[model samples]
Target: MGAMASRGFDHIDTWVFDLDNTLYPAHHDLWQQIDMRMKGYISALLGIAPEDAFVIQKDYYRRYGTSLRGLMIEHGIDADAFLDHVHDVDLSTLDQEPRLAQMIDALPGRKLVYTNGSERHARNVLARLGMEGQFDAVHDIVAGAFHPKPTAEAYQRFLASHEVNAGRAAMFEDLARNLEVPHELGMVTVLVTAPGEGEAVRESWELEGREARYVDHVTTDLTAFLEQLHLQR
Candidate 1:
């Protein structure tokens, strides 16, 4: 939260967040479980080896924003089953981050989570983080009609449904590409960088913020970032 970063988010009235790596540190190792579950489900569904499934999963994620979306389009797979199986991985690794929760609570305006995952998954994560009731709403993939971030449709849907003034809002996400639409829509975009979680296209997908102009701010420490904003307030 340097002067520039603080000014970037100072006028935002709606705070949109991407869950997963954005809220919790990447070193927490929670996403590793989810990534494995996704690979397992893909392997079992397509009758392929884990290694092959891994390749397909990453490819689909890059091409369609989410593997489930790609599965639906290419294989006619049921979205619900995929979401359930992938997100059912253990959450025992996540610990309540009170300071992170405090940073969020202290922020002014409406808070919302717009994740590519399901409402159940979002709730579980929030509960684990001790911030379950903090959000004004949870806009999941279901709310996005199976479209994920980087999809203009999903962003439009979230804004319309929540009655958010995109120009007066800010979006914080772990993935750089996901911030593109938010930036185009006139929202301040913050990229939350985390450690390598070893996902399908993680390397290519993670660090694009450095070169992407859509990213207005970048921070590895989300709690500290938000805390600084709070202190400025």
Candidate 2:
């Protein structure tokens, strides 16, 4: 680690992580399930073709930060039902990541999972990863009043609810766009990337501008990054 990365980690007392690809490797294709589900949900809700729904889904994601948020605003769809349907993904492929769990457990201070997903989904993912009880809390989309990450309001709500001081906090996320707000709030931001291009599951838009100034660090291997922090401490 460079001196800047080391210094950034030194002041962190609250570690916030994005649950999906950030916790588990993107190669697992878990988000692909959710992506398809979202398209299906939109198609059914809007009485549109799957192809058309795909366009609308990506549009809403870009405009509102989440497809759920877009549906709620544009069509007034039931957020709870939408979340349940989209997050009903099979986790059989996600094996227990004991090494990753141990690294997370060794991190100092309060740890949290802050996701655009539902709390139930976050918990389920954590359980599957063998990281149950490793976090202080799971702040989900509902907790932010349906506002998703990358939005200042959502992050503000998370900070207040968790009593976290942004100046002493660090956030880890796979989507670089989601880290902009946290970085602006004075938290150190880490972008978790896929191990290789062939393993990437995120959309191009999600990975755009990943090298932006808001990102303090970028690591393809989150376990190794956390282990490096442990060694530094």
Candidate 3:
């Protein structure tokens, strides 16, 4: 770990973690299911082919921060229905990580799950990981009024709702772009990376800028990172 990475959480009283890949290993392919569902939903909604829908999905995700957002803006799709459909994936593939649960529990102060997905999906994921009730609160797309992360407005709304001091907080996210706003807001930002490659869930553009100055830390294993913090404190 670098110097900043080692001591960055010393003053952090609030730990905000992104769901999906950030909480669980990306190799599990859980998000891949959601990604496919998203494409399917878009294809069915627009009466287009899957490949064509995929292009629009990625384009929307790149331009609007989320595909659902783009769909709403362009086609007036029902956000709730879209979220429900996309998140309806099998959690049986995910195994409970007791070590991760323990490490997260050991952290001091408030813990929160901030996700662009629905609260129901976040809860299901937590239950699958045996981490239910570990977080003080969950701020989902509904809570943010459909504004997703990487957007300054969404971050501001989250901070205001939680009464969190950005300087004393730390955020963990799988996507580098999602951490940009948190870093700019003075939160210690940790980019959680997964092993292997050729994952369709995350795009090449989404994984860009991993070495950006805004990212304070980067870790491939979230459990080990938290364990190190436990020892440091």
Look at candidate 3 and tell me the lDDT of residue 195.
69
For every model in order, what is the number of clashing pairs? Answer: 0, 0, 0
Who is ahead in lDDT, 1 or 2? Answer: 2
The local lDDT score (0 to 100) that residue 10 gets in candidate 2 is: 81
Ranking by lDDT: 3, 2, 1
lDDT of 1 by residue, 119-156 (tens): 99999999999998779999999988898889899899
Best by lDDT: 3
Instruction: State the weakest 10-residue window (summed lDDT) of model 3.
Output: 1-10
Model 3, position 30, has a per-residue lDDT of 82
Off by over 4 Å in 3: 1-7, 198-201
Q: Residue 89 of candidate 2: its Cα lDDT?
A: 95
Per residue, candidate 3 scores C-alpha lDDT tens digits across 7-119 of: 36788999999998889988887888998999999999999999999999989999988898899999999998999899999999999999999999989999999999999
Please write out the lDDT profile of model 2 over residues 122-201, one tens digit for every residue. Answer: 99999999999799999999999999988899999999999999999999998889888888889998988876644245
